[model samples]
Target: MSDSNTTDFTNPSTFILLGIPGLEAVHVWISIPFSVIYAIAVLGNLTILFIVKLEPSLHEPMYYFLCMLAITDLVLSTSTLPKILSIFWFNSREIDFNACLTQVYFIQCFAAIESGILAAMALDRYVAICHPLRHSTILTKPLVAKIGLAVLLRNGIVVMPYPFLLMRWSYCRTNIIPEPYCVHIAVVKLACSDTRVNSYYGLFVLFFVLGLDVIFIAISYMQILRAIFILPTKDARLKTFLTCGSHLCAIVIFYIPSVIYSLIYRFGQNFPQHVHVLLGNMHFLLPPMLNPIIYGMKTKQIRGRLLGLVTR
Candidate 1:
C-alpha cells in the first residue's frame, strides 16, 4: 500500500463491492447453491476435456470444437466463482482498482471467446451436415486448431484495450460498487469523470465481438436447417437435427440470459438493485453448470463415454 501522504483519497485506489446487495441475510445460504454449481461446472468441463483426450475416436473436428467450448466454460467459471464465493462466504469485498479491471478483462475476454467458439462450432456443423463430402477437406485438424487459436487471439486482443480505457477516466465518486463483481458499466457508474466515451466504446465492442458472432452463428444454423429439410430420408434429417440439438441448446443457454441481462442493465433503470445483481451472477454461472449437461444428454458419444466413466 502507498503511504497516505503519497496517495490521493479522492481518487481512491481501492473499491468495495456489495455482493448481491439486499440479500446479506442469506448470503451463506446462496453460497451453498453457488458452490455446488461451481463445483459441477469445474468438474463437468474437466471431465469433458479428459474424455475427449482419452477417447482417440473422439478426435474429430466436431469433438475438437466441443473441446474448445469446454475449455472456454472452464475459464469463464474460474474467472467468476472465486471472487464471488469470497464475497458470499467471507465478506471480502475490497478489491484493488487494477485487480477489478483485470477481472473484468478476463470475464469479458472469455465470454467473447466463448461466443467465437460457438460460431466456429456452428460453422463446423454446417460444413459437416450440408457438405458432408467436403467437411473432411474443409475442417482438417490443423484448420480446427487454427480456428480455436483465432477465437482466443481475437477476443484477447480486442478486450486488452478496455482496462486502459477505464484507466483514463478518473474515478472521483463513491468507491463502492453495488454488484458482486466488476462489470463494465457498473464500475463505470462509480467514476465521477465523464463516462460517455467509455460507454460508447463498450457498446462498440459488444456489437463487434458478441453481436457479430450471433449473426454468423444464426446464419450457420439457417443453412443447417435448410440443408436438413432437403434431405431425402427421414432418418437422415433426424440424425442431422439431433447432432445440432446439443449446440443449439448450448447457444440458447448462453445467449438468452446474456441478452436478457444486457437489456435489463441498459434499460431496466427502475428495477431493484438485487434484481440486477442476481441476474448478473446468474448470467455468468448458468451456462457453465448446464453446458456439459446439455452435451451429455444430447450428444451420443459424450453420453456413452460419460456413462462408461461413471460405471468404471
Candidate 2:
C-alpha cells in the first residue's frame, strides 16, 4: 500500500481505476459481455436514429424525443465504456485527472438529460392520449425544440460545477478508484478536504433533476391510463396502452438500476464492493443496450421501418 502522506496532496496527475475490485482475475472474461452489450447499444441506437431520420412519418414529437434520447445514450455510454474496456482488457487503469473530470461531467450530465427527455416524452404521451385533438398544436416543432433545449440547459448547468468543485479539492488520499468509471461521489470521496458541499450538491442534483422527472413521468402515465380506460372500446384502449409500452420500459430500465445503485452506494455498507460497482456500471449500461431494443420492438412505425431497412 502506498503512503498517502508521501503522495502529492493536490489533484494527482492521474487516478487509477481498479475495475470491479475483487474481480481482477476474470476481467478478460467480464469484458466479453460488456463488449457485446456496448456493440449492440451502438448498433441499435444508430439504427433508431437512421430509421427515424429516414421515415418522414416519424417526424413527430415522440420520435424527436426518442432521437434526443438516442443521442444522449450514445454520449453517456461512449463517455465511460471505452475507458472501462481499456481497464478490463489491458489492465490500463490510469485516467488523466482532467479526463476523469470530463468523464464525470458527461456521464452525469447526459444521465440527467436523459431523465428530462423521458419526462418530456411522458408529457407528449399525455397530450397525445388525453387531448388527442390538440396533440399536434401542443407539441409543435418550436415547442419540442424548446423542450429539448431546456433539458440540455438544465442538466448542463446542474452538472457543470462537478469538475470545478472537484478541482478545488485536495486528493491527499490514495488515487485508486474502485469502480471502472469516475462518478461525482466516487471522485469526491477521495478528497481529503471538506466535501460536504459536494455530497449535498450531488444529493440535490439527484432529487431535483431525477426525482422530479420520475414524479412527472408517473403523473403523466396515470393520466394516460385514465384516458385510455375511458375510451369505451377494448381495441382503442389496447392500442393506446401499447403506445406507451415502449417508453414505460425505457423508464423502468433506466430508473430502477439508477435508484438501486444510488441506494447501495449510500447505504449498503454491508454489501460487497463489487455489488456497488456493478450496480453503478449497470445503471449506465442497461439503458443504452435495452432502450433501442425496447423501442424497436414496441413502436410499430420504427419496427416497420427497421424491417424494411433489413429486407431492402
Candidate 3:
C-alpha cells in the first residue's frame, strides 16, 4: 500500500476497496448471503440457457430474447460477485488500477446491454400480443441477430471511453474506494483533476442509453396492454396478462433498485454511505438472482423443461 504522504499523484499502483464502509466488521457475515445469491444466480441462469438450447420447442423469438436476458444477467453478476466475495472472505481488497478500470467497463457495459435486452424483450411481447400474425415474419432469425449485434455495439461503443477517460486523470486524492467493486463514478471521483466531463458523460450515458430503453419499454407495454384489453374474452385478457407478468417482474427487479441507487448517489447527500453501497450492490445482484426464478415459475414451458431436467 502506498503511504498517504508519499503516494504518486500521476499514477497509482492499486486502489484499496473498503467493502462497504460502515459494515466492515460484518463483511464476513455479509459474504454468506452474497455467496448464496451468486451461486443461485449462476446456476439459475445457466439452467435457463441450457434448457433453451436443448429444447427444440423453445426455439422462438421470445425464447431467444429470454436467452439473451439470461446471458446478460450471468455476465452482469459474474463480473462483480466473485471479487466481492473475495473481498469479504479473504480480506483481499487491493485491486490493480488497470484491472479496476476493466471491472468498471464490464459492469457498466453489461448493465447497458441488459437494459437494451429488456427493451428488446418488451418489443417481443408487444409484437407477439399486438401483431400475433406477423410475429414470425417480423422477428425472424436474421433480424434477431441484427438486434443482438446492435445492442452489443451500442453499449460497447458508449462504455469503451470510460477507462480512457479515467486513465487521463491523476489520482492524487486517495485510492480508497468505499464499495466492494470498482464503479465508474466511485473511481472517477478519486481523480485530483477536473472531473466534470467524466461526470457529465456518465449522466449522458445513463439518460441516453438506460433512459431511452425505459421509455421504449414503457411504450411497448402500453401497446401490449391496449391490445390485451381489446380481446373479447376475459380468459384471453387474463392469459395475456399472465404471459407478461414475468417480464414485468424482471423489469421492476432490475430498474427499481438502479433508479433508487442513482437518485440517492446523486441527490441524497444526507443518506448513509452504507445505504448507497447496499443499494448499488443490490442493483446488480437481485435481478440476476430473482429473474430466473420469476421466469421459471411464470413460464410454463421453462417450468416443464426444468422438471424434466431434474427428473432425468
Off by over 4 Å in 2: 1-8
**Which lDDT tens digits does candidate 2 get at residues 16-41?**
88999889999999999999989999
Give residue 257's lDDT in candidate 1 (0 to 100): 92
The candidate scoring highest on TM-score is 3
Per-residue CA lDDT of model 3 for 274-312, tens digit only, reads 999999999999999999999999999999999998899
Candidate 2, pairs of clashing residues = none
Tell me the spans in candidate 1 whose CA falls farther than 4 Å from its real position. Answer: 1-8
lDDT of 1 by residue, 1-312 (tens): 332223345567877888887998899999999999999999989988898999998999989988888888898889888988999999898889889999889899998998999999999899988899998899999999999999999999989988888887776557788888887778888776788888788888889998999999989988999999999999989987988888888899889999899899879999998998888888889998899888878878888988998899
Please, what is the TM-score per model? 0.95, 0.96, 0.97
TM-score, prediction 1: 0.95
The candidate that achieves the highest lDDT relative to the unseen native structure: 3
CA-only RMSD, every prediction = 2.9, 1.6, 1.3
Q: Report how far residue 162 has shifted in candidate 2, in Å.
A: 0.9
Worst 10 residues of 2 by lDDT: 1-10
Off-target runs (Cα >4 Å) in candidate 3 are 2-8
Better of 2 and 3 by TM-score: 3
